[model samples]
Target chain A: MENKILNKLKNSLDYLSGESISSDLNISRSAIWKHIKSLKNKGYIIEGKSNKGYKLISCPDILSAQELIPLLKTNNLIKDIKHFYELSSTNHSAKELARGEINNGTLIIAEKQLCGKGRFDREWISPSSGIWFSLILKPNLPPMEASKVTQIAAAAIYKSLLEFDIKVNIKWPNDIYLNGKKICGILTEMKCDMDRIHYLILGVGINVNLEIDDIPDEIKDIATSLKIELNKSFKRSDILVKFLNHFEILYNKFVLQKDISEVLSICRENSNIINKKAKLITYNKEEIVTCLSLTDTGELLVKDSDGKEKLITSGEISFRI
Target chain B: MENKILNKLKNSLDYLSGESISSDLNISRSAIWKHIKSLKNKGYIIEGKSNKGYKLISCPDILSAQELIPLLKTNNLIKDIKHFYELSSTNHSAKELARGEINNGTLIIAEKQLCGKGRFDREWISPSSGIWFSLILKPNLPPMEASKVTQIAAAAIYKSLLEFDIKVNIKWPNDIYLNGKKICGILTEMKCDMDRIHYLILGVGINVNLEIDDIPDEIKDIATSLKIELNKSFKRSDILVKFLNHFEILYNKFVLQKDISEVLSICRENSNIINKKAKLITYNKEEIVTCLSLTDTGELLVKDSDGKEKLITSGEISFRI
Candidate 1:
């Protein structure tokens, strides 16, 4: 009965008088009050008194099941939304969720992560001031090839920031930077046998509203946020929606087109290290080399002082200003 | 007092006669019995009875702080050993253990994994029949370059099996196959920043003593074990020791040599996919191609029927007869 009243209210534009809803739906006034409370708990903004009835104001913009469901306009890209108020890590949760029979495009979002993580077991501070989410993708590729997803995510985040007219550069591997400070990071976790990848979780964290003080002093020099760079506060909801839409496009191209050259080209165009003097540090040796270009297969091209060119797929990059 | 007694036992070449130990150790017979029982509980094998005192026969080949301390002889490698009776996953445990202050070569081993997993969230059956372990590596390289460690591990495993006269073939990207069936798999998980790798966990699983029936039918067609292939049960403890020792050598080379061309050369020599007619399957397309050779950087060289050669870093592979 309460659901019926809510349905009527959702379909109608007029003010839903509580007493009228109670009488029309054949429910008690207290019952109407209880339904309104439940809808409010689910992020519905219902206003007005018991006698004056309830008025639907506005909904919360958080990425909860309640909010995300109505906004899921794409076909099969986002099949489900699993929201957590707090978790150890969104990537860990998404990995667990993917282990079950969850469909592709499953989105796992957490408001806060107790043990949020970055690449190499670094602690990621996700204290409700940033966007912590993981998307489940079943890309048609082998496990070794899953790194392309990280490149696609880097491209997507770059494109999203471009929409806001923000100049964001991609740091090779998978990081979005503005003015040499990291604004976003992407980690792609995959499962595969010898031949094929079964599923992948693209874990992304964007520092949307984090203040400079919120980030630790040690990394404050290297990490910046949208609010810090823009000198204005923007809604994380809008940023997340923009990122998701942009990600869907690049991801669709990646899975459907099988050609990552275009995506790679875009990433190279926005890459901060391309054509720059840099230091390449590996396990045993550190070479002072100049960044030449990125290969079509996603490898970094570097030239030594002797002008010898080398293709590097993995190593640390240090820009030599 | 127990430490003193253990130390004495370590020095003693002969099992002390019961009366002699009772007098020399200044402990009663019953006390000696109790201490011997405790040592046994800690996986020390003791021989002889109360009247004969106790003789140390052989220690259990288990991964423990005490057991591994004597076995660990490498510098800056095998700094610590964490053994678990059961865990969610060794890779997960190692990643967590590596989060705080940890030295390179910290090893995490589990006898059983309740939620053991492989790449892409696939369930990795890690019963007592396999060696399930993860090694924490702090290579001074960029995170994207961590794939070289996988190549090192593949080379190590291949070399170790050759020591036993076991004919094993490598299936790209990182699997060991015997008789055209997989016997081992490697998963390399790295934490990284945009520029450098923070740390990495190289998880390795090898089926040692499992019989044919021990494997599920669906996977039985694609999986094999040492015992099944050798027609005899082998000691898991021996294989584990050999693997660790072999891995240390390759790992040292990986860190000290920086370039993995030496390791990759060995890997290519053992890989069965080279010079074979193959089918490359990506998400968007499948093509019949001939394996030409392997790049020094580990990319596969494939020549399509149209006589066009391409270097592929990621895709599924199937050998065409």
Candidate 2:
């Protein structure tokens, strides 16, 4: 009921009074006023006056998929957005959704994830203010090529941040760094056979408007949110819309055109670890090598200490500025 | 109730009368006699006389997970088994099981599948006599190295068939061919990120005792069964136990020892397409090439017509006798 009133208020942004809202939604004036008050408390700005009923001035910093779906401009992705107030993990939910005949670009977002996960099932600090979501992509590619989604994600997020006049560096495969600290992480999980991909759940968690107090004590030194870095809060929906748009553009280039040049170029242009020495860890073996460049297949081409060129396909690399 | 009677009968292989069984199990004598009659009609050999009740002779060709469980020797793979009389697909069930905190080596086997699935989501005709099962294995390896599981499965099935004195050729990746017809197929699906494997469900479908009338007309030309080739029915439980044992051994060596030597050797020795000319088909291209050898990384090394040596990672190859 509140959602219907909120949608009506958003639809009639010019001027909607409580009397008209009550008649339009078949409710009482007090009900309309109560929902409007609730929406305002939830971070929706409504200019309610004597004559002018409610005008939506601005949206709050909430990762609400209902609000974000209308703002997403990507085609064939996130057509059906499953929004949750809290979830165990978006990727886990996406995988269960993938088991069914779910379509590509179906986005699953949660305002807060109690057990958020990163790559290799690592714990991710996903606060309520952070943007946590998972997108199901059924690419017409083989399983071996599914690893390229992370690079595409980096390209999308890096380009989206650039539109906001905030430049961030991609830390190789999946993590984005801001001022030498982690700002965003991408965890791409796939359900696939040897030759064909069934579906891939790209779980992206971005620290958009989280404050320093929202972060945990363990990761406080390593994690930095956009609000803390800029000392100002930004709307999460705006970043998501920009991200899905950029992602759809680059993702088409990858799947349709079979071209990854634009994604690689963005990674190269915004890379801070390239040409610097970093520690690469695979399984249990660790080696320090000079970061060379991103390969055409999206692998990290580096020169090891033995002066031998190695292609790091799947591993963890820590970069130091 | 029926399974309990079967277990009691199996435990007491000696002659046991119906009156004694009824008193021991606290059931009516007529109930035990009816279940025994049903088991006999379903293919269990029991000796019944005037005074003596029933004596177990031999197990039949039914693919019963309950019957196969006691015969299995694997340690951690299948302690908890889900036996389905019929399922959509065992891999689908196994994948759902993998989504939870399902332990490693959890197995799901169905006596029949309503909608069995093969590689690339292809339809697999699963009749009642065929062995359709999926095993969930959580190996500590990267997702990039998951292609080796197919080779491990091929080796296990190949060695298991050899023990029964039935010679068959492995058709490249995961198909077992008997008398130039495909007798078995393997479909391996993984859930993972770029760097680590979460869990893999290895689906093995063997046409062990499928009759001629049971085979579909469209696939009759290219498919065969052990009973059709050998002129007799083989015990499905025997094959399942042998496969589980062989797979556990090879899988342990592959993951723990990091030794794929045995698997590679089996693949090479029994591969009929290793030195033959085959047609390779990729996403939108096809080329005829001479198969050279299996690389250490489990990729097929082939030489094209232009004297170019190319390593093929994921594609379909059709071989000619």
Candidate 3:
């Protein structure tokens, strides 16, 4: 009853007929006014007088299901949206949710994470100025192939940034660089059977409106935010909406096409390390190698001076300036 | 005080030296006799006499840290051995322990797991008749190179099983086959930064003494236990000890060798599908390809009839035969 009254009040802002809203929603005029006051306390603005009913003037820049749902454009890519004011980690919550038979594309977004986690159990500081979210995807691929999801996500973020005319480069494995500084990171977690992938969670963190002072000194030299790079403040909600839209398109292509070599080709073109001299490091040894190409399965092919080509499936390689 | 007394009793298991045992541990004679009775109930056979000391005749076939520690031959590979009678999952416990300041080569062994997990979040039924355990390794490799750890573990298990004159075949990814049926599975979970791996938990499950009826009906066609294959009972402790020794040796080789191609070569030689006709299935399409070889970094190379070689990093491939 409260939701209906609130919706009517919000709709009235768009010049919705008050009489129609009252009759259609079967709510009293006084009840609508009361709900409007409640919505105001929840960071929603109303315009006009009681006689004209109400109009939604603005919404707080918060990550709520109500706020994100209206902005998301994915068909079924985001079946459900869960919002956490604060959490230990969005990945931890999403992992537990995945265990409970949640549908693919379920998303868990948090405004702040008390114990945000980075790769290798490192601490991720997720304050309100960043986007901290995990999306559940059940791709019909083997467990090993699950790495492609991360690649696709990186491409999606790259494409989304291209919309804002922001120059971006994807670091191999999972980092987004802007002006030689990392602005985003992705962590892909997967559960699989021997031959098939059950589900995967793509945890993404983006520094949006974070100020330089908000970043730690150790990472300040290496990390930068969109606000810092662009020298202007942008809406976090708008960036998220753009990301979801771009992700939906890329993800659909990945699922439908199965082979992301074309996408990989695009990523390689925009990537800073392709066809460049790089230092490859594995568990056993490190060597100076030349980047050859990316295989269809996303393996990085590199050749040594002796012309010995190696297909690297997993490892960290850095481009040497 | 009680643990010290138990330790003393375990060390002096020759005769019922009640007065000597009590004096050595500063415990009462009645308390010593009570502990002996408890040990008997838990499957320890002790011979005792009024004047003679206690003698350990035999022990029950249960996996315990106390029993496995002496059996392990690795220098620091088995640095810490945690034994659980039953737990949710050995992998979960091992991962949690790895998050702490635990050393590499820590092993977590469980006789049973109520919610044993497999790749892709599938449930692995680990009864008392199976060897359910996880080993923590902090290999100094990049995250991408961690796949080699899986290959190394599979090779070690295959080689170890060959010692028993069992004709075992290496299954692609990580499974050991005995006479065309799966007897063991390995799941490798890793924590890593972009450049380096923090730790990895390699969970191994082996069907040792399970009867045919013990396996679920759905998996019965694909799974076989040692007892079912060999038509006899084998000692679980013996196999565990052998695996630890083999793992330590292989891990050392992996860390010390300049390149992992030597190990990959062994894995390829032992693989059942190499050079065989197989169907590779991905989300987008399926193709019949001939298994060419495994790349040094662990990608399976397959050649289509058109003579184009494709490196398969992730997806399901099955033998057509």
Task: Give the top-scoring candidate (lDDT).
Answer: 2
Best by DockQ: 2
lDDT digits (tens) for residues A1-321 of candidate 3: 655655565555375545666788787767766766877877787674656556778878887777777678878788888988888888889877876779998889998888887665677778888999999888876556667878888888888888888879887768899998889989887654335656788999998888989788988878899998999887777788888998888878877766586668766877766787888766556788888877777878889878899888665666643
Q: Rate the local accuracy (lDDT) of all candidates.
A: 0.77, 0.85, 0.78
**Model with the higher TM-score, candidate 2 or 3:** 2
For B1-321, candidate 3 gives per-residue lDDT tens digits of 534544665676355477777777788888887888877776778787766767778877777776677577878787778888898999889866865688887889998889987765677878899899999888776655566777888888877777888768887778788888888988887754344666778899999999999888998877899999999988888888888888778778777674566567778888888888988775557889898888876889999989999887655566643
lDDT of 1 at B158: 85
Encode model 2's per-residue lDDT on A221-258: one tens digit a residue: 77899998988888788998899999988998889889
Put the candidates in lDDT order, highest first.
2, 3, 1
Residue-wise C-alpha lDDT for candidate 1, range A215-292, written one tens digit per residue: 889888888888888888776667777778877877787677766877798889989988888888754568888988
Per-model interface RMSD values are 5.8, 1.3, 4.9
The stretch of ten residues in a row with the least summed lDDT in candidate 1 chain A is A189-198
By DockQ, is 1 or 3 better?
A: 3
Q: Is candidate 1 or candidate 2 better by lDDT?
A: 2
